[model samples]
Target chain A: MSTGRKYLLQNVAPYGGERTTVLLADGVIAAIGTDVTDDDATIIDGRGLVLLPGLVDLHTHLREPGREDAETIRTGTRAAALGGFTAVHAMANTTPTQDTAGVVEQVWSLGREAGWADVHPIGAVTVGLEGERLAELGAMAESKAQVRVFSDDGKCVHDPVLMRRALEYVKAFDGVVAQHAQEPRLTEGAQMHEGIVSAELGLAGWPAVAEEAIIARDVLLAEHVGSRLHVCHLSTAGSVEIIRWAKSRGIDVTAEVTPHHLILTDELARGYDPTFKVNPPLRTQRDVEAVRAGLADGTIDIVATDHAPHTREDKDCEWAAAAFGMTGLETALSVVQETMVDTGRLTWADVARVLSETPARIGRVSDHGRPIAVGEPANLVLVDPAARRVINPDEQATKSGNSPFRGRDLSGCVVATFLRGRATVMGGASCDEDVVARA
Target chain B: MKHLLSTGSLSHKQAVRILDTAGQMAATQAREIKKLPTLRGRTVVNLFFEDSTRTRISFETAAKRLSADVINFSAKGSSVSKGESLKDTALTLQAMGADAVVIRHHASGAPHTLAHSGWTNGAVINAGDGTHQHPTQALLDAYTLRRHLTGGGDPSGRDLAGLRVAIVGDVLHSRVARSNVQLLHTLGADVTLVAPPTLLPVGVEAWPAEVSYHLDEVIDTKPDAIMMLRVQRERMSSSGGGFFPSPLEYTRGYGLDARRLAAMPDHAIVLHPGPMNRGLEISADAADSPRAVIVEQVANGVAVRMAVLYLLLSGNESNETKVDA
Candidate 1:
């Protein structure tokens, strides 16, 4: 392990400022912009590297405890580290269903033992994801994992009563209810985003209103109950507008747009390929512009990679029958760089705040998304901002190859990722860490 | 064509070829023996992931009439844990050496998946897939419409040029409605989609058709034909804020009853892709009427499917000369 060893990162620029030297030692930042006197310490050449706080994914589906064929904490966090994420909130939709305190603790521990990244468990809002009754929210909130986020991702909390109650219950422990905002009845048998493309393709349409309506309702409910509400994977322009309006009114609401949603649109579904099929399906270019404007203006709070992983069977099939997500952990940063930073829609400082600080705040992961200062934990990533590469699925870190952005040339390759001073990834290669064997 | 996934993409020339070929297949069915030696050595598979006895039998008959070996595999009950059934089923069909796979799945784009996934070297014919499309059904409907309009002749070079078609009821969830609207438009027909404001999709205005809520107004237009789409009871509580008050209300407003049928043009016809709802979308009186042509649509389904199978599988690879023992 690279822990306990001093390192000098020379002439690297952090997201907000000019180039400066950052010293890492004893699992924390020893100094920034100062010459160190450790003669035996390592020296890392960061002349051309752009450093950012380690990416924190508020939404990730590390399919563990069951369905490990797709992804596990060990591989998933490694992929996360490759994408420059030091912490990821594992969603509650697992085989046993991460609804209880016990399940969340197990997932949290698995991530800890993996030693690649910190994995905070998101408790399920409803038991078994049935949406009929509430899960033990208080128990999960007080569990060993200290799950501060609760969501029934993949399945929407459709019932107004259930949604309001979930929003209310989570507020007691300062937990935020991350809602997958979709109206179930409207989206029944829905294949893709309802629009001109769906009309032409003849596939059943998942209208933008299905997501917007729920968000409109939830924001009101959150205000009524005086609680914080987080919207997951906000896709449509109408959704962004509603969230913006709610935020303007001072409703305790924050919204996130996934990296896939930021760049991709519904036109990709023209080929009838299942790879493009996702929940809150991709919308039109007009909606895409609206979301981009929303993100640039800070109406949308953060960039989340609803990083769902599915096996080939789950994705390489009919669009309607396919699973509803893309593997985003390894490709999120590149996507953001191409769509946001490269487009001049957002700066590296904006990227830092959205990808790390804001998400960590939403998930209540205080330890992961800290500033690049002396005495702070060394959770950071080094990016060759000028480098570009076409994404190859075979070279991906995820077990699944369903990267929706396959073959697209994207810039900003992650060269190294450090989790509390230990380099999980160094120079684009994984550093060998003594991961605990399965007990 | 490698696949007949949807009528949405089928060109006017290709559609006319299928129709003209069906004219020949329909002639074969009128003969004493419907069997042919054209596909004697070929193998065709009917991979149905959805339960549709009518469509399954129609395709099976189409392949058998051409003397091709047929394999009927129903993957109805399998381990559908995250859509593995489709992949496993597709791989099995690939290994079975089936020359063509006629697939009918509940999901909207299964045939497109089967064709483009490269799981098989065979051709793909979409029988019906979710609410997305049913190209064969549209072909048969077009075949029936053309035959009824101008008396049985070669529609090889013809399009439904001056024909006006009104597709009534549940346009939101009806694959039949979607496929017909596209195919009919491509054939140079003017289509008016008649539905409750709720039944039509949000972006129907973008489709190559005009929309109307009143069936009587559509009937008053004296259209060349009125095609009634099947209305599902489940869609009432869902799609568009409760589409209708009740089944009776829907039948009264849009149902093709005797009065509405009488309002159509004298030479006009009525088409329904069944199993019919009895008195729901179309009344029993109208369905049993001589002008209905619903039965003829079923009979033409076989012929259209035969034409699709023949065109897909009867390339130069066929022996073309086989002895009848």
Candidate 2:
């Protein structure tokens, strides 16, 4: 762990509750309530700030150890801190593919050296994400990173026997296989969502059944094997229905929705802008409404950033030619607040549950997603709920300018972020600039 | 209009104005000189990211006949691997001071991206985009239909209010079908799309055109015109050959044959945006028939493209035609 500093937060609402004083020292919540005083602490007047446990992302692409031109652990974690995330599960689809224990540990160590957020490296389920044979899941789970999550995110593990074997095998290590639900043959040359918009746009349609079919098949497979199954980036309405049905059947499946899907729709693709182009491409407004309702209820368990970053060269061309992703780490919280909180679909406490607590619980992170009590780890974020800012991708810490939310005004801002009593971000920017730069 | 990207966005007034301008441009082509100085000193770039010698030469001939400088830039490959090439090519065209860019790309929406990207100030004309829109092709087809079906050969200020047109074959991948369905509907013509179920898009019912699975059914109706789309054999292998069972089976189902040709009205014209698959989508008897306007469609394509270049480059769009054809 990096060296931490003492801090005093005065009159901040924990989980948007009554204002109270909290003290941090020795990388833990040393004291709380009135009379919590420390002379050697940096005093913060947190008026009108809603404090909550720091956000933990179940899905984030650091793009480190490869594709550093887009993002690295250092930049990605800094962006996470700015977005109020204290921990992030880096996806397995990197250059060399984070399948082995050595690679996951390397990524974990890079996150430690960055010191912005605690990086949990997710191991790949398939070797090189090829889906031909399983990777060393047992070894990676036992490694230093202790990867409990295994996934072939960019490519789906389509082979039923392989998926079944993976589902059955990961149970030995209490690991969950996060599936990127896509049927390859059904989505051949798919550019965007298969709908009226795609019909007119002339781009090949990515039918909802393509995702639903795999999700349906995998959920049944998971049930038959009786192992943990996690679905990534559930976009379509039919997908929500399937997951709801799976959950109703008491199947051990948990699903996540991205920030982009909550508000943006396939109508955005009418402009043919590649920035809106994503895998499991943005669905219609009806799908958007369905996902919002799903998340509002407990049907969708968590909200993951899926914070993919791509350089301008990848996104500045025709829709068919562009890469499939958007940068989300920086604007994730603000988007959640605008879509979930401000819309009355969720409260601040629910925000903490979906964005921080639930994700941490799902990822089996013990230190994070803890209550703001005395002697707990001080991984926290102070957000000004009334504050708002237009998202500018250039101003983001991530090296990519492919933010789909660029130029849109979003509510709430991270006033400060604390990672174990250390201010990774203060005054809406990275704290300890010189120290961070050197580290 | 700043750009002719898609016919779906074209208003009735804009569509007619273009057809009228094309009619005047067609009259000019009848002259012995067959040249115009309307777009003189203008630089028109024929940017072909997909190789279509027919489209490139047609655009080239149109630009040259208008006395505009035409530069052909062909960068052929999958747009997926040629992502940066499109942007780089656009920037290069911007640097070269192109006044109008006639683009034909393998990727759908490539022309839309170019027109709105702020990379160049040129007016973009879609020669054809990936199964998306070929606005000029649709325009020339409308011009052809109007000349033969409407107000004799001098169809000015008239739209095909009640003309029935049946567009056959590969509606799923034909940029021609997509563009024509929209433009024809805008011009008040009823369009029936006849194709195999596998060859039609999922949401094609939402389009303005009515759909038919039987070519003989549409041919039995004695539509004013039948436009046969090019059926690429590569689609057979690429789409798992699931689009149809065999060439003979497809011809038996949707092909415009000699018997189907004889069933049509005597005045009903035949249209094909060629390099025709003579024995595939259309047989030789139908393609070479006296009623077929396939060759005339090519000559009209030049006039239609010239009108587009003239209207766009002459700064006289959204107004009456000012040139004497």
Candidate 3:
């Protein structure tokens, strides 16, 4: 539908390069070789930039049609794009959630209208996310929206029989059920991760086994059903072990870790700030390292932003009274850079793989997470890995101001983001004009 | 900031601040017109899914005293009894314009689920969940301890440093014990749990505090306070054990009888997470003793909850305003 010549960076090395150029035409990278002359081509310098495949998020909570005060599709997608993502799977935990074909279509249409990132609406595994009855999974998978991911994300699909059925049912469409694995009985009164911190804090303990138990059961179920199961926001070391064992057995199970879980520990709960409160509540330092090791050793498949947003009122309370989520969209990459890259735990290529390529493949997003090569769609990001900035919630794009990283200094800045050869973010600021034009 | 849910997430500093602020709230309770305009424009909904007398009243009284509009929604005889789900009830509350919800349910993680499930934008405060943690109860108990043990100086400004507390009786089913153990430990108090093996919950060794089987042995340690938990008779029917030979035997051994009371240091106080089984766990004399702060604990519950609410909600706002200025 459109044709234009755009050069990204010329003579850039593949993984570690200081300067490079990529020429784009008709939404794909036209060339990547040394300087070529084109009369009407736009030239953009890509010096000191590492171009990555457009990022993909397997777990994102785009709260829309309900709790719009916290976030909406337009705002959430804009945040995702600014964070260098080209595709994101919208979690099916909204009010009047995406459990049916109708709801899935509504979310898909909204994403299409927004035109920022490719939004794949995840259908709810259970009706109303109650975990009692199966939703119309077949109909949702076959809908115009073409749902490929089903999840009771905010709540675990705890019933063994129901989980098995949901896993087996999605096989027809090659869909995956992203499970929020927590055993209900084990975490009955749990307010935070159960450990020494929980005991000292006197909060009800949410044991790691609660999450581990379900992961073990579901991974076994996935093997039995011969279907794909994606573990959502795996929090503990024990969960990492279960996922590792599942992967070793060649079970079709993939696990994701949130940026917060990789960086934070339950010791933050000692401050009694509710911003630290989260589902699959934050774990100990040992668990934090285990998640890092999991991410490094390939036990964890992807780094997904469980970009859960909650209002100030939801989080500004006594530790026990407050809500259990913090805004992550704007901070995920910065955290990953700080915790993983800065610490020398992962290379830039590893970052591109975990944050983008692998996630897109897992969610089956065709247009995104492509290698930054000729003929591939120009869904890409240019990052300045050395830039450092302190997190300010007030400056974030999300409507919610419940970020836990407030005032913490983080490195790595997303200089530019391109979705389908169109610049969504340039010079480290979102292209408001382009976004408005897309809308 | 909105409501006191469980004691688990509180830090020593935050717990101390709540207790200190509670002291000021307690001072207000003695005033002629005991109400503040802090939360005047806010609407607090008390949604009790389980039957409760003291906890409900404490929250209601706290909200009213803070000048917040209060809505009482009890599950008994309400639409909840007609099989309406928690989600439906939350939606109804949201429609009714609730700013905060104070919920008590028989299910342990129901409030946590409601708060995190995106069902409503309103803040959620767990009043009590099944065998979870009762945060405000711990707050009041901490407040009571500070007042009696820490002298006229505000105990809230500091942690419960150097204080030794012994909690005796049913730990298995008592949410009160769970909360107190957490809050007291955070406040730097040395806590000892005294309960029979049958009465203690599994995995208690994982707890931060010490566990003892004999109250007499615990009394020899000369604790700053001895909190006697009410042994719920209902649990006896469920567990199917003569937990003691009888109630009389419990009174003779673990109960805060006069002899055990005498064994305590002169300044050691008596505490009970009340609806006190007066003669069963504590004698009338001990309950009414000058050193007993049981009633004071109940009165302090309101002030402590008010402090928790004030610190969590208003403190952040004030801090932000200062930062802006």
Best prediction by TM-score: 2
CA deviation > 4 Å runs, candidate 3 = A1-5, A10-14, A17-19, A36-39, A433-439, B1-165, B170-191, B196-209, B213-225, B230-275, B283-325
Candidate 1, B1-325: lDDT as tens digits = 4667888778787788888889999999999988999899899899888788999998999889999999999877665654667777888888989898888887777788778778888888888887788889998999988887755556666778878899988888788888898999999989999998877887788889999989998888899889988887776676455778888999989999999888888988999998899889999999999899999898999999888888877755343311000
Better of 2 and 3 by DockQ: 2
Candidate 2 accuracy as TM-score: 0.97
For residue A217, what is the lDDT in candidate 3? Answer: 90
Predicted candidate 2 versus true structure: per-residue lDDT over B1-325, tens digit per residue = 4788998888888788888888888888889998888888899999988789988899999999999998988777645366888888889999999998999988999999998899889899888999899999999999999999985756888999999999999999999999999999999999999999999998898999999999998888989999999999887777564688888998999888899999999989999999899889999999999999999999999988988888778966445542211
Query: For candidate 1, lDDT tens digit of each residue in A89-161?
Result: 9999998999999999999999989988999999999999999999999999899999899999998999999
Q: What is the lDDT of residue B139 in candidate 1?
A: 89
Q: Estimate each model's TM-score.
A: 0.92, 0.97, 0.72
TM-score of chain B of each: 0.94, 0.95, 0.92
The DockQ scores of all candidates, in the order shown, are 0.51, 0.79, 0.09
Sorted on TM-score, best first, the list reads: 2, 1, 3
Each prediction's interface RMSD?
Answer: 1.9, 0.9, 8.2
Across A198-254, the per-residue lDDT of candidate 3 in tens digits comes to: 654456778888898889999999999899999999999888888888888999888
Model 1 interface DockQ = 0.51
The docking quality of candidate 2, as DockQ, is 0.79
User: Of the candidates shown, which would achieve the greatest DockQ relative to the real structure?
Assistant: 2
Q: What is the TM-score (0 to 1) of candidate 1? A: 0.92
Model 1 segments more than 4 A misplaced: A34-38, A130-139, A158-172, A435-439, B28-34, B76-82, B150-154, B232-243, B316-325
lDDT of candidate 2 over A1-439, digit per residue (tens): 4355689999999999889999998889999986778898889998999999999999999998789999999999999999999999999999889999999999999988888999999999999999999999999999999999999997899999999999999999889999999999998889999978888889999999999999999999999999999999999999999999999999999999999999899889989999999987899999999999999998999999889999888898888888999989888898889999999999889989999998898788889999889989999999999998998989989989999998999999999999988888999988875565443
Quote the lDDT for B209 in model 3: 89
**Model 3, residue A123: displacement in angstroms?**
0.9
